[model samples]
Target: MENSPEIATDAASLRPAGVSAVALSRLASATGGQLLHVPQNADPDEIAISGVSIDSRSVRSGDLYAALPGARFHGADFTRSAREAGAAAVLTDPAGAQILGSDPGLPVVVTPDPRSQVGAIARAVYDSQPEDGSGLSLFAVTGTNGKTTTTYFTNSILRALGETTGLIGTIEILAGGQRIPSRLTTPEAPTVHALLSVMRESGMTAASMEVSSHAIAFHRVDGIRYDVAGFTNLTQDHLDLHGTMEAYFGVKAQLFTPERTQRAVIAVADDDDEWGIRMARHARAQLGAENVDVFAMRGGVVADREEDPDRRGADWTLRSMSRRGIGHRFELVHRDGRSLRVSTGLPGEFNVANAALAALMILASGVELETLQRVLDDDDPLTTDVPGRMQLIGTEPTAVVDFAHNPDALARALAAVDPPDGDGRVILVFGATGDRDRTKRPLMGEIAAREADVVIISDDDPHGEDPAAIREEVAAGARSLVEAGTARAVEVYEISPRAVAIRSAVQMAGPQDSVIVAGRGHETVQEIAGVDHPLDDRAELRAALDEMQEGRWERR
Candidate 1:
């Protein structure tokens, strides 16, 4: 017999593929969440899952319906719908527990706080409990603008270097060949761990994920221990959830806490980066964390003589960088006195920074600089394209779809595709999100008016926010430029329907011109008045451009 140490695995210890009813009870009990329903002597190894679903419409027969409570609607209200669709069981909060009485025949579990505990419960019930600390390396990137792109870049580079990888971001989750559509910026804790386990089983050695401030604040990433935590940058976003900018930053800062993380990769060019470094330093002193790495894109960069001067910064300095046609070339110099010149087919300086951040993160993972560089230069950066982050739609008169909803990101996008050195205008189409950071509306308008030649204020998921009011505020800010004589008279068109605005903008764009369909990037659905309408900016932009081209063809 082979002398192998017996790995203690139980019903609860079994992986998600082997989960049972007893597993669910223990998961709820561990989190101080109460379980209302229990089958006597239920087996804990009978897996009762295909996956978990929060929406009734998507709930399948084996799924656990997470009946969460929201301000606008109670998830319990959808319980009947979930059951009708064949959900195995319904999970709800203490308040929603009463809804279970309405349907006694349903297999219902009452949780103390469904939203907070669901992730933990999900992790406990599905995953083979992580043995203290062990298994695949996990890297999480968080920021307002670069989260999705940076994660995608890292995933691509890792895969290029021959490591099977898993990625979760704004675009999709790449687990093996499965491309799961992402429903949250950072999946709730249970789904996160479950996905990680699946990745590990699918032969992934590493996983790159995007973490959002909302996820942190809501304790969405509660149970998993991240090997490397990256801070891309921070700016005004999701203010409705955090209430203030300081609060938003506070939530983002929690990811770096000693209790939660081990290593960190922070971007120094952002003001939030300076604060993050400070927070990391404090956490290090308090918790004795060993690996804290920093990379600066510009401005705050500290170059050393030992490092190549042609580089942007000494510590993983970006150097010899140039844009050739539709691609970029740059050098990454590590602290150990090694440099590798890399080229990416992706355009824009922002992408260069994103690539640099990925390099630093890969370096932090103990991969050889040259090997990772070869992967980035040869395989990853060339083919990888983040869904909504600076995703260009057409040529001649170019149209791009970007998720630049805030002022800072909008400013960066404006700086990125600077009008192609021509007499044509940079037209913008965007609208502020409803019930979110109302303060940023005028700022977004101001940036658009200041940066672009023509501004088209349009709808961007005004979700109960008066579309006209949102557009009016943005237009008001844009019109301020003309009123102050700071700009060469800008046109502010109030196009309520987003598609109409996109069509209008694309038609107006000439050969030397560029049209930015801003705000909604990779999002496939647009939420309006509590309903998600199917929408894809990239597809719409493409169709609109094709229409414009067809019209031009007819005119000719």
Candidate 2:
């Protein structure tokens, strides 16, 4: 809220995504940028911006193009293209100025750290703030996994309470009723402020978001203030970006700081990982005990599992669960001894934890327990189907689609959907994403082999990396278990063209067998050689099942 500003303007000045026209001098002053050049014919006060975009191709007329540094090349390399696309001004660092080639007569706001400062500039440009004079209640969830599910749960439940809510996560953005695909777990700072501005303009007063470790470290959420910040358990993920486990924990811990958040809702179900414990300690040190609440898994056989669910047995707990057809009716007991009973459409015990954590966030927001009980007591109840998180596709073979992309997620998902003794077989069909932390590839293989009777390794977002090579690494991990005789009945298969692998898994499923299609759950595209080929795991799985029902399904 530091750089937030107020300005009086009419409808003509309002631009796309709710960005308002602002003086060039004002943007420069807010960003502390050195104004390199101004057009000879244009006045600094008269120059106006409609929006901000990092991608050159998406740049629009009267937009401010932010050209930052990238892994392969300087984004400023596209300055001419942005200019051609009608960008009114450019924001970049000194390095980008060099790439922009001395003047060219366009106004350039040059800052030493553009990425860290853009969110503040964006907030000023768009006049993004709660219109009701009350600060917008922003909620966020962070962890290696379950973040998307938690965000959806939090947002959906809030909506059920008759609140206009915005949602941002790894999957998509729901600005009121408008939905858009997510490009990052947490978008760039400017994008965050812009989207918030859009939401406010669309009559939304609150928002739920997923904050990623990379986003925290990169300052993607630099200027936003969250009302409630929740934590799912940390695990082995994004090691490719953060480099080490400790470093990953360190960045994730930043979200709990009092500067970024007000009230905290942390899931402390994981008895193994101490990061959540350390996070609670850190948050209490800054925000004090009253503002921080740590909730952990208290009942159900879920807590006894090896997966660290990050429950601390502290302020609140979930007890007495009665599951009903891929759903559960549970009792949420708070530290103050008050309890609320609720039901969720979400399957898997881990989702019960997600819903409980979300309910605690609602409680922290001052919703009455009786009100929540009434909502849950409704004939329909409040439940959300998070795309690809235990999404069931068939009843005959009992197939499910999930976004369990990593080892811990794969393990927990397998455990959640595992069949009982003499019940049936658990067949897993999955692959690892390319250009990610290679360490998890083999670990994913290990989990599938150990948990499922049939393991089919395939492709997932190969990117620019070789598809065959990525498959081999995962297969090696699963095959290692077979060589060790630990997963004796485990049968492994290596397949390509993901559709083929999915079809094979479907055909192999017998009655009572559960076929899980992991990774790339809600994703609609598969990356290969820098191109996104059309593909959706859910769509493909459904197609495979439909074909099987028609007695025309075949696999090679």
Candidate 3:
């Protein structure tokens, strides 16, 4: 229950400098909330509000403190602290208003649901989208795996096109070159608007953000609309929250609506399940066919499918891909016969999908094909490094760290790293997240057993669940496949404390073998039993390789 130091100081750092204040009454009226408890001498319209914050510890003077209801406690219980921290007023639900009782000594805006209104209020207070329409050209990507990489690619491409860009995603938030550590794939609504305002004030012209399903379900991106929204792919993950894959897809589908994005770019590559195709159809229905662009890898199952004529062609088709170093160089051919040759240094054919989606999104945002092609060919924006995303750490045994936590992602990562024309084995070290999608543990295990020569089940973010239990579930799946004689003779071992498992994987790898540390990619901390332990896969892999090299040198 300790207050976060970042939250305590966020008021000064996260809030944009010289933001134009909006009248308190205007926000209440805009959100259709009842305004009450204004000071006797103050007119509601004259009470200026400079910012918005959901966390009381981050409240600053002239900020509207959004006191929402939580599962355990009502946020209005912290209103006194928010007031002491110089909050101007309170925005809360009726229950929160009741928690404050009467005469709370500040103006209160009461609504039935405050969580849904936080984004709108923050937007108006920060003027994130200026009335003059000179705001950041917002781009958002949402899906299971490639959201982070696609956004990074989008930001890089935007920069390549001579635009000052900002980024909001899993690793960090870059606002006009100022880097801030990120805690979520998409942060809370207030922080989202505040970051956008910072980008605008710092003269950034475009910003790319990763929008997670949790963000959409929780209304984190309530009011802000993107110039272009991209979907990478949907897979079996986050079932703990959404309960069903259908429901999960429903939440991702929300981002492509006309209200959330001006244009939609959907990737339908290898769409055997047809989620991508369904998403494209939904987007086109909602935003009109002109505003929706479908992208596919030319030889993918979906692109080659002859059953449905509607799924036959995409606006952009990735074709003629040839391996370039660890990654692939591919050509993005449009249905209109315009083609742009692009490449991503990041490994995996899926990254080719991510890079293609990024290019299509930029083009959908009104960037000319010639300009985009110039950036792709000349600047090679898609070749930029994305942390923890197929990030290669060593060359001798081919060590890699990736954030492929789900069954689909894990399968793809294994396929990408499998030794091509060698006796090299695929050594995988991975574990399911505690307290999330329990069903995926066995599926991931079975995949590891099937695809990898050696499987080391290690703890990811155990959270509150018992790490041993989580490992056993994954081991059960792997063991089932191995015992059933359906999979290759894979050696599966359960190793704890994660660091040891990583070292073990590295030690087992040979010069031609690949050691992949999957899950928790780009994440430096591992959360277990409400505590964070420092654990960077990249750093650990490098240290292990260094140790191996040092030992070899000594032996020689």
Candidate 4:
């Protein structure tokens, strides 16, 4: 986009996909909202809301436009555009009502909490009631990280089992068989219900979705019950929004409750991360011991991958792991005598953890273990290339691309990228996203310094924040270790342009070293100021790696 009013922002892409034409009175009854400026010719109950849209530009005929209040502008400010776009009704709060000032003919639904009510109203409009084994078995996966990978794994497994599976997550939304890249980690309430409605209409048998902290905090998944809600460990992330780790975890914890989910799958691989343990206990209490299962990896990740064979209380165990080319194969033994032999092409230890959680969640959904194992045994298993999650683009210096933005994710990515020789270095090129969770910047710096041999701090998405300042804050955190002589052996670089950071990291790396380009995984655009600049980390990393290879050949 060109940073203009005419340019549809990436957010517009998150607008609900299907049309929702429910009676106006149904929406009012669903939200306990009162209709304002009711069209007299049309019965308040008879006026249909054909669709729901938060963005005025995308409003279609018979659509109900939600004028939600935000920190900057009340959604009502665009009421004129919504009306011009043929909106049937407007949903807004009292403040928005005041802004309208008796717009005589335009139908409106006045409610105090439009944001929270959006999902409920949307569910009513789209007729997307996910009853027991309705159109698809819904799976909700949430955590600070690994959400995307787990969703991918679960969806791939479902498809391999001959089920038409839909997937909604950070990477994209898959309905029927169509793939739509997502604008949010989780779409807004109306969009989510609308998408589910689409899948239900398409006769999808199962769908796996990534539920983010923002989704839970904002009730984005309201009115929809999940068959399985998977938690992939909690970590220090999004502190800027939640203010504390406790608050953040509280939001994630809601997804595991009986009211929100029917079953739960928690990864207990890293016993050190106690959050999973707590979530497991909570799920057992809420969903029953039979409804909950824990997975600990003893097999897939290489030597760096740790497994507690004597791990207590785990229902499923990856008993052993061995490498086959770039992939790892493991045997997953259930609490019962049943077992599943699994394999994946991805090399990261975190992928192993994600796959384990995905596998257990699939099992919880009632898929036969033998059938799932047959799917993993195919020449291609779980589709293993998850966009930009630890994707290997080169061999000489072992270039890898990952989406590790937060401190916890960054630390895990560093620890998982072990080179062949023990002395080989892990070179990381990553930066914290600007205008989001500033609290994580220093924490990320400290963690990177502790885990990585070389750190190149650069731009992720400046998004109106000063790019240089963001780098300085992260660099300052890492520099603290150097000043104390704790991380003097760790080399650090402060690069302005991210392209330079990626190339510099690759150039400085030798054959024994691994170069990891973190952040902005699978994203083709980088937001700076108000415009999105075309950029892909995977593409940049590949170009850099190729350039280095050509240079080496010329030198010979």
| Per-residue lDDT over 346-370 for candidate 1, one digit per residue giving the tens place of the 0 to 100 score | 6677777777777778777788766
Cα lDDT, model 3, residue 167:
82
The stretch of ten residues in a row with the least summed lDDT in candidate 1 is 1-10
User: Residue 333: error of model 4 in Å?
Assistant: 2.8
lDDT (0 to 1) per candidate: 0.71, 0.79, 0.87, 0.79
lDDT of 3 by residue, 1-556 (tens): 1112122313225777868889998889988999989988999988889988888888889989999998798899999999999989999999999999888988999999889998888888777888799999999999998999999899889888888888889988877446667888888998889889988887889999999999999989998989999999999999989999899999999998878999999998654648988888888779887788888775454344333435444777777999998889988777778888888888888898999899899999998888888878888888888899999999879999999999999999999999898579999999999989898999999999999999999999999999999999999999999999987636899999899999888888788999999999999999999999999999998998998988853311
Top-down TM-score ranking: 3, 4, 2, 1
Q: Taking the tens digit of each residue's C-alpha lDDT, what string does model 4 give over 1-556?
A: 1011132234334333455467888778788888879856778777878778888887877888999988899899999998988998899999999998886358888888988888887777776764444646899899888999889888778777877777788887776445677888888877787778777777677888899999888878887888888988788888878999888877888888888888888886545557776776677777777788877664332132223322336777776788756667778787666888777778766777788888888888887777777777873445456898988888768888999998878887887786756768888888989889888899888887887888889999989899999999999899898778887236888986898888888888888788899888899999999999889999998988888878853311
lDDT of 2: 0.79
What value does the lDDT take at residue 297 in candidate 4?
A: 60
The best candidate in terms of TM-score = 3
Clashing pairs in 3: none
Model 3 residue 276 lDDT?
Answer: 85
Worst 10 residues of 2 by lDDT: 1-10
Candidate 4, which segments miss by more than 4 Å at Cα? 1-20, 130-133, 297-312, 552-556
Write model 2 residue lDDT over 240-338, tens digit each, in one string.
999999999989888888778888987777455477677776776677667887776753422232223332246777788997677788887776688
Task: Write down the lDDT that model 4 would get.
Answer: 0.79
Error of 2 at 305 (Å): 25
Q: What is the TM-score of each candidate against the true structure?
A: 0.81, 0.89, 0.94, 0.90
Q: Which pairs, if any, clash in model 1?
A: 16-126, 311-319, 312-318, 313-317
